[model samples]
Target chain A: MMLIDTLAQGLLLGGLYALFAAGLSLVFGIIRLVNLAHGDLIILGAYLILTVTTITGLHPFVAVLLAASLMFGLGWLLQTHLLNRVLGADILPPLLVTFGLSVVIQNGLLSGFTADSRKLAAGAIEAQSVDLAVVTLGVMPLLTFASAVAVIFALNRLFYRTALGRAFRATSDDAVTAELMGIGPQRIFAGATGIALAVATIAALYLGTRANFDPSIGPARLLYAFEAVIIGGLGSLWGTLGGGIVIGMAQALGASVNPERQILSGHVAFVVVLLLRPRGLFPRASD
Target chain B: MTPSRPLGLIAAFAALAVLYALPAIAPRALVQDLFGVLTLLVLALNWNTLAGFAGLVSVGQQAFVGIGAYAMFAAIILMDLNPLVGVLIGGLAAAAFALPMAFFAFRLNGAYFAIGTWVVADIARLGISQWKALGGGTGTSLPKGTAKDMAFVDRIKAALDVSSAAAADALTYWLMLTLAVAMLVAGHVFLRSRMGLGLQAIRDNETAARSVGVDPVRLKALVFLLTAFGTGLCGALAFIQITRVTPDAAFSVIDWTAFVIFITVIGGIGTLPGPIVGAVIFYALQRLLADYGTIYLIVLGCLGIAVMLFARRGLWGVFTGRTGIDLLPLTHRPPKSAAPQPQASRRTA
Candidate 1:
């Protein structure tokens, strides 16, 4: 019964990881550029939601809609103005630029937020939980998991059933050919980044509501997202969810055994996965 | 790039002389600052070799540094070895660690390699923190009088006729200087060699390079091991001055890797003298704006991004383009009379 409860908790936590990774995977899949600032941008989104909630005294759930739009604009601007110029055959420029952006966002948030851990108050919802037959789960975690699923499902629909998704797939497959067909790859990239950041905003809402967050936590979160993406395979969204669950389960189990090993166990799991299957469990991309 | 002029070589040795003798006449403060600058230069050079020439943009260099520092601490505190030997052991230990690291990270190409290395570094930091003998998470320091008792402190004290502390400072500064100069010269020689040509070829087009008998994996792994040794040596030597060893400080990606990456990018990624120019500018920036909290890093990050977007070649590349003069040119040129056009001999180079 105890082990069952731990697995349930792990599975719930994996939902948040999936949310964290969904935007990252989407952006990487489309642009072929891994934004190192993905985690920091999520942190920035949380800060935006916090500021909006504080200034307007609106519920965080309501504030998040405005924050997500704001993040989408910022992401669009960032891609068009900065990231687009650096994208090229040489991978160093994009990687380094994103890394620099990560540092800048982290420190910029530090100056603004002053390193204090902040959380969003959700009233009674914060204390609410549901008792399943096997275990009791927090309402927030359950909601977060549901959001993750919805976000992934929506992204899947957007990828397959929409003209923008066709543009994205065409551009990702061969930018030159896409451009020959009158689709601007840069515009597609900007759209992808904007959507990714909007998804990140959803992740940020859950992040701020669930636990205390500060500027310095971004890099660790980035590492976790990277691990999730890698473990799930590069282009597989469902595989990313599986990767997140693997990490969350390993972490929960490790914490049950020894508190210090929680994070290490997740990393160890990543290495183990890599050792067994270098291409990840469900590799959708041939590359 | 212009042909290397003998006069530039003469000027370089002259500059090296001034740098070495500065500890004797200049204020101790300046020497210490230069020591710090030189530390960054060494790290930037090693990083350039990986990211610039070999196309291995590893973000987990702090792993080698942290491992080196910890190994040095263990050597001194637990094994009771001399600090100098510990520094050597630190480099060797880091290189040994790199062997396994290469085995793992080499599986990932391009940007994935960068994140792969960062993960390995985090694992190293966590693993090292569990060592109870080395003070674990909180970290430990060198014993009292450890610096004073280091080899040649007595000799440096007698020669310089300075206090033991200053002598110790001079000794460490001299070791770091030697390492820095050695790396610069060795880097030049290595990059100019056939193997260096092969490495660059791999970077430019791995398929073509392999088609032409260049072994990408072997060369990349070798570069990885060598850079790890260099980084580890720098780490061990750096901690000797810091006199402390904590997992947080030793494994600080921001201080060790991020800063080094910025220095490399903002200078010139593939150029030898780029890090030197970048370090000078970085040192100046630090001195000017360090008073403002977090602003210095903000500026660095901004500059790095700006360089990436607008000036991929960086300041050194811009300088070389404008002047047509490379202080240490990597290109080989035949005599002007021997060729109708300069582009003729550029293929092999």
Candidate 2:
């Protein structure tokens, strides 16, 4: 029963990890370039939402709706201006550029908000819990999990069932071919990054509300998101969800034994998964 | 045919002499500042060999530094050995650690490899934090007067007639200078060697290189171990001056990797003199903006991004491309005897 309870809680935590990973998966799926600044961007979104809430005296949830749109614009501009210039055969430029962005964002946040950890207040929902079967779960965690599922479903729909999704896939498969077929690969790439950031904003909502976050923590968060994306494989969205669950379960289990080892265990799980599945659990057939 | 070769040799000797005599003539603060620059230059050189030449862009170099540091601390605290000996042990231990690290990280390709290395570094930090004997997470400081008793700190103190602290600083400063010079010379020689040519070939086209009998994995792994050795040695030397050992301080990604990466990127990625140029500029920028809080890094980050966007080969590359001046050339030059005199402009005749 105790084991079951731990697994249940782990599943909920996995939702948050999945949320963190979804945007990262989206950008890599289309562009095949991993954005190292991803974690910092999510934190930036959280800060944006927090700023809106404090100024407007709005609920954190409502504030995020505004933050998401702004983040989408920010993402669009970032891709159009900065990342687009670095895309090519040599992977060094993209990697280094994103790395520079990560440092810039962290320091920007540090200067603006200081290194203090901040959290969003969500009122009664903070204490709310739901009992399912033999396990009791937090209402917030349930909401986070449901949102993750919805985000994945929506993204899947956008990917396969929408024209933009086709463009993304077309561009992902071959940029030159897609360009010859009358698709603007650069525009498609910008759109993909913009959507990824909007999704990151959603992740930011859960992140800010769930725990305290500061500027320096971005790299570690980036690590977790990256682990999920890798362990899940490159092109599969649902696989990323599974990867997140695996990491979450590992951390929860480690925490059950020794709290200090919680984060380390998640990293260990990543290593083990990679050792077992080098291309990840569900690598894209083409990749 | 070019004057660069002679000029490079002259500049190299002059720089070495100046660096060697700085402690004697220059202020102690200058020695300390140059020490910092030299150490960063060493890190940048090691990173350059990995990312620029081998095409292995690893963000987890801090792992080697941290591992090297913890091993050094353990040697000093547990075995009661000299810090200089501990530094050698640090380098060896780092190389040993790199084998398992390479085994895991080598499985990843390109961007995944970078992430893989970063994850491994995190694991190393966490594992080191679990080491209770070394004070675990909170970490421990060296014994009182340990820096003063280091290999040559006393002898230098007597000769230079300076305080124990200044003597200690001088010892580290001299060691850092020697290490940086060694890396520069060795990097130049290695890049001009057959193995280095093979490594560059592998980077340019792995499949073609494989067809020609170049083993990418073996060569890259060797470079990884070599860089790990250099990084570890630098780390141990750094902590010797710092006199404290903490997991966070030792494994700090920004201090160990990010700034070094920035330095390399700003100077030039593949070339030997790039790190030196970058390190000098970096040290100048740091000194100029020393008053600002976190602004220094923010500026560097922006500059790094700008450099990537506009000048992919960095400042040194641009200089070399425009002026055809390579102070430290990595490319092959044919012997004068092999050149055809038929089309040559013979000024002597």
Residue-level lDDT tens digits of model 1 in B1-349? 4345577788889989999998788888888899889998999999999999999999999998998888898899999999999999899999999998999888887888998999999999988888889998899999987878899999989988899988888888999999999999999999989999899989889999999999999999999999999999999998888889999899999989999999998998899999988999999999999789899999999999999988888899887776666776676666789976756223222
Residue-pair clashes per candidate: 0, 0
Model 1, A170-213: lDDT tens per residue? 99889999999999998999999999999999999999999999
- List, residue by residue over B63-131, the lDDT tens digit for candidate 2: 989988888988999999988999999989999999999999998889878888999999999999999
Q: Write the per-residue lDDT of candidate 2 for residues A230-278, one digit (tens) a residue.
A: 8999889998998999998999999998999999999999999999999
Which candidate tops DockQ? Answer: 2
TM-score (C-alpha) between model 1 and the true structure? 0.97
DockQ (Cα-based) for each candidate: 0.87, 0.91
The superposed Cα distance between candidate 2 and the true structure at residue A230, in angstroms, equals 1.1
Candidate 2, pairs of clashing residues: none
